[model samples]
Each structure stands twice: as C-alpha cells, then as structure tokens.
Target chain A: MAALKDIIARDYGTPAVVIDLDIVTHNIARLQAACEARGLENRPHIKTHKSPELAAMQREAGAAGITCQKLGEAEIMADAGFDDILISYNLIGEEKIARLAALIPRARIIVAADNPVAVDAYAEAAKRAGKPLEVIIECDTGRKRAGVESVADAIALAERIKASPQLRFAGFMLYNPEDAVAQTQAFLDEALAGIRGLGLEASIISTGGTPNLSNLGRIRGTTEHRAGTYIFNDRMMLACGAAELADCALHVYTTVVSRAGPERGILDAGSKTLTSDIGGLDGHGLIREFPQARIARFAEEHGFLDLSASSRKPAIGDVVRVIPNHVCVVVNMVDRLIAVRGDEVVGEIPVAARGRIV
Target chain B: MAALKDIIARDYGTPAVVIDLDIVTHNIARLQAACEARGLENRPHIKTHKSPELAAMQREAGAAGITCQKLGEAEIMADAGFDDILISYNLIGEEKIARLAALIPRARIIVAADNPVAVDAYAEAAKRAGKPLEVIIECDTGRKRAGVESVADAIALAERIKASPQLRFAGFMLYNPEDAVAQTQAFLDEALAGIRGLGLEASIISTGGTPNLSNLGRIRGTTEHRAGTYIFNDRMMLACGAAELADCALHVYTTVVSRAGPERGILDAGSKTLTSDIGGLDGHGLIREFPQARIARFAEEHGFLDLSASSRKPAIGDVVRVIPNHVCVVVNMVDRLIAVRGDEVVGEIPVAARGRIV
Candidate 1:
C-alpha cells in the first residue's frame, strides 16, 4: 500500500496540495518585514497551513504569536509550543469554555467575546479553573458575521470583561473591516475612547485580512495584525489585488483524468480538494499551466475544466497545478500537504488542525 | 487533551456529523427492497457512508456489490472484505492503474473508461498484473461530466475494451440521465444495439442517480442501479423530490456561536463542515429546528443564518441540527460520524474513505 508520503515522493498521484517552501519562506519574510517596518506585531493566523512547522517559521520571522479560528486549532498550536495564541472566534458552549480554561495554564490564551453572555461564560469557566483568561471584545467594523454592532456595545462588553474577576480585558479584535483604513481607525478610536471613559485600559487592538494587510499601518490604533492567507496567496488574493500569481505558494496538483470533449476535461481534483469557494471570482480555481482554462464546475471528486478558451489543451493523463480560489478552506479540506522547493520534495506537513471545526 | 471521541462521547461539541443508524438501516432496506421488487441489482455506492460496517449491512440487505469513485476507496472497501466492487470514475495515470490492477486479484473489480486512452492504460496495468480486468464503457446519457459522447462512441470504446488482451468488456455505465426513463431507455437501447451489431456481448447495463432511482424500472435495459445519497438524503434530494425531511439520515449538529443581530445568527458549522454545494438550492442548508431560517452566507468557519423569516430565533450557545445541501460531500469532510438511535449514542463510524480523492 502506497502511503501519502510515498505517493508524493514519487509524484505518483494528483489532487494533492503541494506547498513550495521557498515561496512560503519569501511570503512569510515579506509580510513580517512589512509589519515590522510599520512597528506592528504580526500574529499570523494558522488557519491556512495549520502546521506547527509553518507556525514556527512565522514565529521565527518575528510573529508575536499565532491566531486560530477554533480552540481545536489553538490546542494543536499550543501543543507545538506556541506560547501566545489568540482564538478569534466567539467562544460559546460549556465544553468549549472548559477546554479554553484548560489551555490557560499551558499558554497565554486569549478568546473573543461579542456579547456579555459569552463574557460571563468565560468568567465562570476561568473562575472554576482558578485562572484569569484574557478576553478580547470582538467589534463589528462593517463585517456583520460576528461582533458587537456599535462603539457603545463594544465598550459595554469591554467593561463586563474588566468587571469579571477571572477574566482580564485584553482590548479588541475585529474580523476584517469593509472600509480599510479610515472607517476601521474611526471605529477603533471611538471604541477605545468609550472604554477609557469607563476608567478601563484597552491594550491590544488586533485586525486581520490579507487584502487589508498592506493598510494595517494606515489603521492607527491596531497593535497586531492577523492574516492567514498571506502565507499561501490564492486566486482570490490575486483577484483582490492582495498578491500576484507569483506569490501563491500552495498549488493543488491534479491530473486530467478524462477529456470529455475538445472544450471540456475532468481533473481528479474537485470540491473535495480545490473547494467550491469562487470568492466572487469567475471560476472555481486557476490552472497554472493552462491559464485560459476555467474550472467550470465540480463534482465531489471531479473538477470540470473548460478548455475552450485555452490554446493549449491538456490530454488525459497529463498533470496540472491549480491555485484554489480560497486557500484556507482548501487547506482545511486535506489531511497533509507536500512541501517542495524547486521540484525537490523537502518534507510533508500534516494539517494538524484540518477538520478542527469545534 | 480531549480528542474527537471524547468530544463526541460527551456530546460536548458542535459542527459534528451525526448519523441516525435507524434511518440508515431504513434507507438501506427501502432502496434494496425497491431494487429487489423491480429485479434490478442494487450496487449501492459506498461513497456516501464509506464505512465498512455500513457496506456490510448493504451487502447483507441484498446489495449485489458496491460502487466507489476512487482507487483509494476501492482499496479500503477491498480490505474490508467487499469482493465485488465497481469503480465508477475513469482510471488514468500509472499509480492509479497499478492500484486498480492490484485490486483485480482480491476483488471482482470493474472499472469505467469513457475513452480509449483510459482503456489502454487499464489494459497495460492488467496485462502487467497478469489479470483479466472487467472494463465498463461509460456512456454519455446527457450528463456531460464524463462518458463517451454518442452511442457509436460508447460502442467504439466497448470494442476497444473487448480487443484488449487482459480486459473483459462488461457493458456500459451511464451517469444519471438528465431526462429519466424515456431518454435513458433510448440511450441504453441505442448503445446496446451498437455494441451487439459489432458482435460484442453487452452483459451489464448499469445506470445510477438518487433522483432517478424510483424510475429505474422504466429504464428497460439497465441491469443494475447505483445510488449514493439515498442512504443519507440531503436538502438537494428533498428539493428534487427524491426523499422527505424524515428520510434524511444525517444531520450536521452545530451550535449557535453568536447571534450577530436580532435577525441574524452564526453557527459553528461553515463550508469546512457543511460544504458550499447549494445544488441549485436557495440557501446553504436547512435548519431542522428553525425550518424558516435560511443559511444565508458562510465564512470558512461560520454559517450565517438569516432568522428574519423565522418567528423564533435561537440564542447564542443553542444547538441546531442542519440537513446540509449535499450529504455526500459533508460525509467526505469529516473524519468520523457519530451514529445514534433515538437520542442514544449507538456507536461511531470512521469515514474510511473521507479524503480518498486520489
């Protein structure tokens, strides 16, 4: 039986996530340098690669800590000796709270809470654990996914965190502001002012998104930035003008299994490997070898590539590399990623937190 | 240090794939009974559950064999003692061909080929293995995803398979016909006539799709039926009138992480857990508790639920069971599925072929 490692070593199969380590290193250095030049702490989100090795590389490149979307991810990073971790998602449920409390002693764990109910739950769990858990109040700066709506609401949540004996108020964390610099800065300034007016100190102000990473310096009050996809720029990032095609470090290696017609072919990579996130792009992913070919549709294990527009169409049994529309979700879909450097296989990194949805 | 097992055991986490065993049994029995009544061979596609235990149940319930989409899945099922297996996708590339050829000795393995290139590859591998491989020519019956274009094309491919030194032409396999019954029957009849006219024996005519299972009897030439999603019907199946809400065996157990606003809430389940396959449906999925609520949008780890249509809204920390837009992909996303019977935790089934995209 050929394991994933053997298959990757021999370049034996398709539908595998391949990461170029050199490109990854360059991407990390570029982002870290950008943040350092602006005097901002770069706490890169580990949700993209989810590898301890990659997270360690980021930390070595001067990242303050790591950011995770779930406690499961944070636990994996914490186990890997990442001392400072920020879970940017709303921490709800007793089970999750207990898990968060357990991580308090092992690492400098910080969690986000958008409401007082979440704040109270965190306080209760921390009190039970006999430890003080750092709480970051999530604020809505136009991204309506999660977070307190207004400055007053953010101040109220911050105050509740400050009032709790077991919870330490650790400033704010917003997902990704719609309007980058001015509006995000205004919202942060107002919320900070409101919190200070309540006689509490707001320390850390964190914001993230690869598209807005360049504008992090423009946002005046943010102390740290958390961008996951910057490590492995994708088609979405390229389309958003965040990175060029040359900056994409990870690519899905796939084989054209069937050429149904002159205009259409099917690749082994599908929604399972490449993901269905178009990210407002025209197609599912970008074929590096065949730039004009569009990933028209996807079955569970079949990516339908439209080769009508391409001057050079690949035959059945030919291999191609696809850059996914969204790299983070694609990373979450696979178990391991093969890391390469200029055609030579360096090593393989297990996506430690691949399916850590909890 | 809570593992997935511990989390599932305590029912402590959200965004878990919960399988109702009773419903699974019923679904298996119902589909088998239908096929039995119509004298059609039930080769249930194992791509849905991908569990050896469930496959055994299906086989015991009178499934003639099992169907898989990848060589990896075939190897797993073959290891689990399933002797008769049909891999529906075209087997290309040396590695996959070698794997398929290896399965030939262990199981009565059959593979599909839409073109001569794949047929030649299969023949080469089977010849190298010194085994006669059963080869089925995939026919295009309207779904242009795979298979040969016309009846003549399918017959040509079948002739190519018959002429191979180590291949046995096993007849045709058509993807779910867009227009069932009349079109399917016509397509099958024409393809059969063409192959017979070439003095080749066309033994097995296999056709499959969950939507066309009820009309399988109407397609006169089809000897076998392959359906995957009928085991755990999804929202797409319900919308296509394939199954009812009560028939859906699987549900995504998710927690309301944040009530973003009065009319909006976020669930822990997102594209990572539930998939972005809307399948021509309106929303991402259907929340069983709040039938009127629409899963409006999804970030990688967050599902935005629009509660504006619902009279009752769930608060943060509340659990909601969601029937995903597509269950097959959802099953492929998770590592293990928690099986339950009337609120009692029966057991857990590891998704043996979860990431078997290769």
Candidate 2:
C-alpha cells in the first residue's frame, strides 16, 4: 500500500479532505491539559468540527461533556452515545420540541434559553418527555449575537423555568468575542459577580473561545469553559492571537493545476475546500510555507493564487498545502476526512454530522 | 405525498435547503434563449449547483456542452451521460492524467492547459492512452486568475499542442471578472482579435458569468459562451448589477429560533447555509420576502439575523426564506436540495457532485 502523501497525491482522489490524526490528537491533548490546569471542566462544542469521532477522542482525553449549537447536532451526538451534551442555543416549535423529547431518554441534554418562549418550549418538551430538563439562562455578556443583555432578563427566564416542574435551573452561559486574554478575563469577572448576585444558584459559569482559551486565568469564576476550534486551529486563529500557526493541524492539500499568468496560478481547491472566511488577521489564511502565494478569489473548485513575482513556480502536478483562514468552516464543507499519520492510514473517519446544518 | 416544506417542517428538520426547480428550469430556459438570440452557444458550468441532475437538465434544454472546474465534477457529468462535457480547468498529475485519459473513451472531454508543464502532462496522458485529446489554452483576459497574458504566449501554446500528435488545439478560453457587460465584451473583443491575428481559429472563446450573460448586445467573435450561476443568480450578482432578485431561485429555510435581544434574532441558518459571502449588497443576501433582515454573524448552524429597525420582528416558530449570498458555495454545503414548484414537492435531487474539493 502506498504511504499517506503518495496515496493522497493519487488514490486519495482530487478535491479530497485529509486530516493529520497525530496533529489532531496533539490539539486535543493540548486543549484538555490547558483546561485541567485551572480546574475547569472542558466542554468542547461540536460546532467547530462537528465530528463524532473527534468528540470521542476529546472525551477520551478528559472532557466533562460536549457542547452543541443546534438540536440536530445534539441529536447526532446523543445517537453516537454522548450522554452529557449541551445544546447551547434557543429551542422552539413543536417539531423541535418533539425531537428534544425523544432525546431526553438517551442523554443528559441541557439547553440555553434567554426568553419566555424558549423556556416554554423547553418546559413543554420536558413535560412531554416526563423528565426535568436542565436549563441555562444565556447572558449577552458581550458578542451581541444572542442571549439576554441584562441580568434581570436572565433571572426572569430562569424563574419561569423554575416555575416548571419539568425544568432544572443550571448556571449562566456566555460567549466573549474578544481574543485577548486580559480583556476577556476582566469582562468575565464583572459578569460573574452580576450573575452570582441574581440570588439564583448559578452552578456552571461557561465561558471559553479559541482566542481566549490560553488566557483563561482572568475567568477564575468560570466553573467550565467551552472551546472547539482550538483542537484544530487554522490560520485565522494564528492571526487572532488565539494560537500559533505551528499549533494549527488541519490543512487543505491541493495541487497547482494552472500557471499561465504572471500574477496568478490556479489550484484545484477552491471555495469548497476553503470556504470564504475573510475576517482573519490576514486577508485570507496564511498559505502555509508559500509566503508569496495569496488566495485572491474562490470560484467553487478553483482558487486563484497571486504568485506573480515568485521565482519558483509550482508545476502542473505540484502539491500545495493551504491552511484555511478558519478551520471550522473548512471542516464543515467536506463529507469525510481521512485521518493519516505519516505513511500509514490511521483511519477513514466519516464527517458523520456533516450537512447537519439543521 | 406532502409538499417538501410541509414534510421537512413537520419533521422539524432545522436549516433546510430549498430550490425552486421550476424557477431554475425557467431561468435556464430564459438564459439559453437570450444566449441563442445573441447567436451564442450556451455551455452551462456545473460549479454553481454541483448537481449532475441539474447539468443533465441544462444539456436537455439544448446546451452545447457542460463546463466543470474539477475532474471529479466532469467525471460525475460523464457518468450522467453528458458526453460533450468540457473540463474547463487545468488537468494535472499522473492520477488526474490517467483519469483524463480514461474519461476520453467515455465522453467528448476537453481539458484546459495554461503552462507548458501541464501541456507536457496532457501530452503524456494522451500518448499513454493512444487517444488524441482536445485542448483549450486558458487565457486570462482580465480575471487575473489563470491563462496566458499575451497573444505571443497563446500562439506559443497553440504551436506546442499542434506539434503533439496526441493533442489537438480546439481553441482559446477566457473568464473575465469584469462586473459590467460592456467591459467583458470589450475584453473578449480584444482577446478574439489577438487570437485571430495568429491565424488560429478560436472556436471556443468561452466566457461565462451571471454579469456577462445579459450584457451581450451582440456575441463576441467567439463560438461559445459559458456561465454557471446564471441558472440561479446569487445575492452577489444581484447586488453587483448583474441580475434582479426575482431571478434567484435558491434559498435557505430557517426558523426564528431565538429573539433574545431587541436588535438580535437568531435564525437556524448560519454560515453553513449562507457560506459567509460577505461584502455583497444588503450585507449578505435578501431574506425571501423579508428584505429588512441583515445577517449579523453566521455561526455554523445559526444565522445571526438583525432586522431593519423599521421591519416587524420575526416571532418564534415563524419561518424565513433566505436567498444566499453565493449559491455555488451554499450548494456545495448540502447533500440534497428539495426541488419545489410553487409550494409543491416536485422531486428530491441529490447533490451528487458536491464536496469535490479536489
């Protein structure tokens, strides 16, 4: 059998996805170690990678539970035997309520709610399932995406859930968008005080991100931290002061197929392998080991590389590894990822939760 | 027997991909008619939808041939009996070369080359197969992505292919990235003149994009024009003055899962459905009938929606149909699209050619 790179260049197929298992294992170990040092439980969200196999590895390396954003993701995780999973998003409707009821029998699924409607849905689902489901009042400490802005709103929702025999009041949950450790720590400190003063027993204070994972000292009040992309930090994380490029494990292996212009060369991997994530420190993610090459445009299966002045031009069959701006999005695009370590094919893991956008 | 939306919503399948097949078919027919009126042959590229079923529809509707960017996409088309398919991308490697050679026996396939190294690879593949392969020299008229810059380089490549008994020079191919119709027409005119001055028949002066299709008051001196996204013009094109929003047939079905804050509402569809195509008009794309909702941040499975202050708030359980910013990228993310016709379930088309990142 051919080794990893040789097979990847040939039978691994074109526009295929390859994951370095060793690198991924290293990332898992590193993150788990970091969370453990501060006596914080690591609940890595499945959203970043959305792989059940990867989640199993994280659990093996000592994760308290798994975090999921959607009910679909939670369903997938629960089916895969993940009993302690957190569906960290607002739940609604009869269809979703039914699915949540079905999930309660299989796992310890906790959901986040910031409003009465969501709390009502949880209550109805829990009552239907004949179980008291855990509910965490989500706070908009920062990152104005969702969650209650003030503590009063959070308390009101918590009280409503408390009124229901079907619900159990958990602690508050938040996502800090800031990347710097010091700033994230300071922000979390005041938010913790405010939540604690609510007179409700806020058990688990969850706060974690790939950017703020390393500087988690300031978040001493955090009972648990949630970080996912840290397992496979991409170029975006490297640029955002989250992690170094050396720590990034997942990379898109592409081939230079066209080099007819002075300023541009074309790669087989386009927006499919490398999705458009332009918010990274660099315009696009760093072109690993190819400082001269910059991704200018993405046309689905075609990536336009600006390498006009490079002395060395990649031939038609030359292989190039690209570290995407955001690793999470890249991993989300493929159907499966081949996990390899050197010449040996460690495993062929299906991106099982792929297309689980619901 | 229920409609697509009814079946999916009843199942509470969050974050669904919906396609108006009637609108798609209508769009295809309308665009083909326009191209035919302009005296141009339409070779629809498969990158937009990445569905062999859709490609077959285009071929059935009198498309001269199909255009694809990857070998995998071309192979899928070939399997679907699209014999006269053009792999409008650079063919590379022993594996790809071998695949290219094998495909020649099954379909009338033509591969593009922009460099001499690639020229040699094609020569070797054809020689190995003992089958003469057609070649198109990709010319970068103004896109700055691929293709030779000057006419001298074009002639030089033509000479190389003509010299090789295994290779046959078909013509020239250029993909201009100009947003205006007039600019692309002018660019094509100049490139055509340059190719003609060399005494070479530029049979396939292939240029395709949503913006360039309607801009053609008259056809350039090229035999065929290619376009993919014209079948379903995306938010980018709609914003770029290319196509109207009515021409857009693809959308994401999402529910207002959470309304935690006054300025923030969360939709089940996120970056995974929208595919993070920023810098377009309206920030992201038009949200079906709700023209007021702006996509704040796309979090994998959750689309952060912030409605216009003037528009009514989306209540929990209320569904929103979102027109994606980039349909091509969005198509690659899903496994199947519910093909509908006026709220009726027409068919369930499997996106067979998706995840072909190589």
Candidate 3:
C-alpha cells in the first residue's frame, strides 16, 4: 500500500488539484443534452468553472450562451469572447450598472431584478445607456433565496420593466437549492403560468440546480436552465443523492504530512483547499476512496484526518484525494490546477477566474 | 439608519474587501505587545492574511518572525525578503522536500514532522541541501489535529530528530485548537520535561490559536506563541468571546441586489466572496452593524438575507458590510483588495499569497 501510495504520489504529487477533463466534458454533454432534450436552452453558467476554455466547450456542445452571476465574472467571459451571456443573479449599484451598460454594447447581456427599487435603478442606468436594458423578473420558487413571491409579483415587476423605456422584460430566473426534481418542476410550472397568463411574453423561464436537473425534461414552461456545480459535482451533491462519487471530477490532492497518532494524521490541504464548507454534510468533505477517514478538524493549512475508523493506517507521505463538500468554493481558492489522467500530469489550467470574488 | 447604511455604502461600496489598515496595524501591535508583555515571542502565522506586505507590517510591529503552513506561502514571504520564517506544517515527499531544501538556504527554515516517515523524508532532503533543518515535534495538544500524544512519544520523536544529522531538534510546536493556553502549557511542559528528562535539549515551546490568546499569559515556560486570525478577528473570534467586533478589521463590502418579500433580499457577496464557512456560527457571517439581517442562504455568488427585522428596507444599490465567519477564507478568495479611507480609495494591494492554496 505504501509503495502504491508513493508511486501514485510521485506521479501526481501533493498539494495539487486534479481535474478529470473527461468527466467535465461528459458533464457538459449530459447537461446540454438534458436541457436541449427538454426543448430548453442550456446557458452554461461560466460561474461554476469560470473558465473561458470550459465555456467554449459548453458553447461547442450546443449551449445557447453562458450565465454569469457577477459583472466581474461577466466581464471576464465577455473578454474571453463569450458575448451572449446572461447575468443570472441580481445586478445593482452605479458601478455595477455602469459596467453592465458598457457590457451591453459588446455582449448580449440579460440580468435579473426582483423588486421595483432595483427595476428603477436599472431603468435609470438604461436611460443613461440610451438603450432598453434586458431584464428578467426573478420568481421565488421555494428556495427563498431571491425572486418575487409569485407570478403576480413577477408580472408586477415585469410590468414595471415594460413601462420603463430604459428596460425591456425578457424572462424569469429562479434557483432552487438541493431541491427534489418533482418539487422544482412543480414550482417552476406554477410560477411560469402566472407570468405567461399576464398576456406578456415570459419567453425565457430559467431554472436549474443539479439535484433538480435529473427531471428537467418533466418541468413545464422552462425555456432555459442554469446549473454551475454540475461541472464538478461535490460531496454535497453526492450526499443529496444528486451525483455518484464516481462522477465527481475535482479533488484536492493532499499528502499525509503527519502521523500524530495511530488514529490521527494531518493532510497537507486544509480549509484553504478543502474549504470550511460542510455544505450540510457530516464532515468538511469526503476523502475519496477513504470513507472511514473522518475530517476531524481543519486549520487554514492542514486538515486533521482521523483514520482509526478505517481499517488502514496510512503512513506519512501518502497522497490522499479529498472531494470537497462544495466544489465551487474550492475552485475559487487556487491559483492554478494540475489536470491529470491516471497519475500522469498532462497539463495545467490557469484558474482564469480563480479569485474574481468581487 | 438608512442614512447610516447609505453613508456606509457610499463611503464603503460592494465587491470590496474592507480592511481598516489602521485597525490592522493596531491589532498587530496589540498582539505583539501582549506576547512581549507575556515574555513570549510572537511568530504570527502568515496563513490568516496571506499578504507579505501585512507580514512585513507584523514584523515591523515587533513579531519575531512569520509562520507559514505552506511552502508556497513561505516562498511568498521569502520573496518579500522575510528571512527568519517557520514552515510550521509538515514537509512531505521528495519534490516538496526538494522545494523545502531549496528554500532552506534562502531563509531560516524551520519545519515540523510528527511521524518517523515524514521526519526521515525531511532529513534526507536536508542532507541533500547541506543545510540544517530545524525540526519541531508536533504534539496533539487536545486539538487532535497533529502532534505527539504523550511524554514518551515526545521523547521518542526528539531522540529521533537528535539522531538525524540533517534534522535538529528544535523544541515543540503544539497546535492547541481546543484550549491553546490552558491545556497547551501543561501538556507541553510534561512533554518537554520528559524529553529533558531523557537528557535531550527541549528548547522552544510554541503554541497557538487565536481563541486562546487571552489566556496565553497564564502559560509558563512557553517561549513563543503563534496566531494568525488574531490580526483579522472574524465572527468566530467574536462568537468565541476571543475578540470584539471593533477588533475585526476585515469586512466584505456588498450591495443589496434584489428584495423579494418584505423581509427577504439578496446580497451581491455570497459563498464565492464571503465563503460558506459557518464554522459553528449560526449564519454565513455577521452583518457587522446590521445584526438583525440574517444570511439565511448563500449561493456561489449570492447571499440571501432576511432583512425584515431591520427598521428600514435595504434598497437596491445600497451597500452592506459583512464580517465573514472566517476572514482567512474570504481573504484567500480575492486577488487584489481595494483599501479605502471614508469613500476615498487609498490604494490597491495585491493579495501576494492570494491563491497559494497549494
């Protein structure tokens, strides 16, 4: 076991992030095919991988466009030549709106605003831009994160957008968290009816979360969907019964740095890499192929793994792979990632939007 | 209240990581002063705020040196001309050891190895580098993270280090997560006594954790103490009664992007910015001045806040200040930070070690 560990270690090494590009491409195709099969557009949210390279792959896979949550993220995508992008999340403020206005001239930009105040803010910005800004009325679909309460609320917001010369109503967007497939579709159907019944065009009904995507075809009236974390399914997805462990593509490659006791050892990666996001899971993350090894604690630089529950006693210098609870948070932490295939270092991807936290 | 929020927003805007440099400098001085007053050397861990500029500031504030958990972080410090540094975590594998060996000649390199396997690995690297590597035995001081368990264990490890020509025994490094001050000294003292009882030199007694800093003065015969989160006191520190809100220097500047229901609104800064580090805390982060606004949910790019409890509604474009549960994680998420002084942008500091997760 030690020799095997060393061999694998020498091949991939420690303190590296390994991504199975094959799995990523597979996920892209599966997601795109699922959405297109449902007669909906698949606007791959670049926010997940935040890689123009990956976004291009999604575009090549028949994606209608890309979705961005931040203007910063959108700016990066636009710069990467992904012109048709949807700012899925809410956009606010003069600084952000000004950026949005500038982006509109170059890219086909659409955004969401859930309230009259935000609608007015966008209208004023659009008036300054001297063009109707594309707007999506957000609908609350049980997640309670954002969006208006019902179709009436959404229509009221859309009507406000329609009244404003600075803004044009485009569609609706809702993100449900770890939602069951049936529940998400039901909520979307209910919300969309109210919007479409208003005699206004709610052409775009966007809804996507990995858990809900398994039955995306069953959902009625959703013309497009946005799901990000599906590119690299994490422990949370596995825990939620959304993805299989074998489907996970990203892992924090950590070396056993310490054997504090027979029961305890420290891994090179910590909250800085695995992240402090439990994502409602039992522990920080799932130690790939080392289920019994519990993540007992996390310092900024080292993760303490209690391996007594497991039958194996891992020696120091052994490389362990950790599938983080939330893949997206882990992605934002690194400067670059080592792309590997079966212990071979083939290439490196500069985490282009690694720290576009703004 | 709206005026105050607007003042804060206009004065301190969104997508910005606000660190009152003045407060930071004071906090550094305060910690140094405390450590000095306790007759202990302060080796502030560079992990909390991975900025070499801040490390230099800490050194200038009377820190004996800086402690880094990663070799990459150590390299960043060395690049900043910081010589006397401690790579507090373990050095593993030939490649990492080779990197460590290369760094040893450039800086006063001190590393820890808790197991025989890792110790020998470092020893071989040190021998190859022709530089004496100071090795500290990490003791599992109630944290259960890393370190030797008993006096016998400590003595055995110290003897092993003494036997290796490349590895020099340099006291002990105990990461006391549970109770750094209370339990650390007794356990460390016993271990050191047992090591000295074995006729081996037990010199430096280092222990740390931001939470235990207040009781640090109680620990006797402790030569040096290391702490990182003390500089940028987080919500966790505040929750643990370790630091005050005023002591917290890092805050994420965000804006209210969408208001759905009466009480619900979405914040621009989410998991990607503030991170999903609940860390035994109730919410994602503290709303700094707005204690009533509860961050109920956090997406990768949006934080859902329930603002119904507040006296007034946080309109779109209005900025809100959030003190993250873990400031360290948030700092690692961004590349460059805009330092401001009352709406005036003072300067932009590159997060020198921003993505050194590896």
Restricted to chain B, the TM-score per model reads: 0.96, 0.92, 0.93
Better of 2 and 3 by DockQ: 2
Give the range where candidate 3 chain A is weakest over 10 consecutive residues by summed lDDT. Answer: A1-10
Candidate 2: the clashing residue pairs are A14-B358, A15-B357, A15-B358, A358-B14, B208-B226, B269-B303
Question: For every model shown, what is its TM-score relative to the native structure?
Answer: 0.96, 0.92, 0.93
lDDT of 3 by residue, B1-358 (tens): 3453454454434667877776787789898989998899999998888888888899888888889877888989998899888777767777776777788888888887677776887788888889898888887767677677776777887888888888888888877664456667778778767777667775677877788686675767778889999888998999898889778877787887777677887888887888776778787887865788888778777888877687766776667788899988888887766565444556767788876755
> Residue B137 in candidate 1 has what lDDT?
87
Badly placed stretches (over 4 Å) of model 2 are A1-7, A13-16, A179-200, A308-316, A342-345, B1-8, B177-203, B217-219, B279-282
Q: Top model by TM-score, which number?
A: 1
Candidate that scores best on lDDT: 1
Please state the Cα-based DockQ of model 3 relative to the true two-chain complex.
Answer: 0.60
Candidate 3: docking tier: medium
Docking quality class, candidate 1: medium
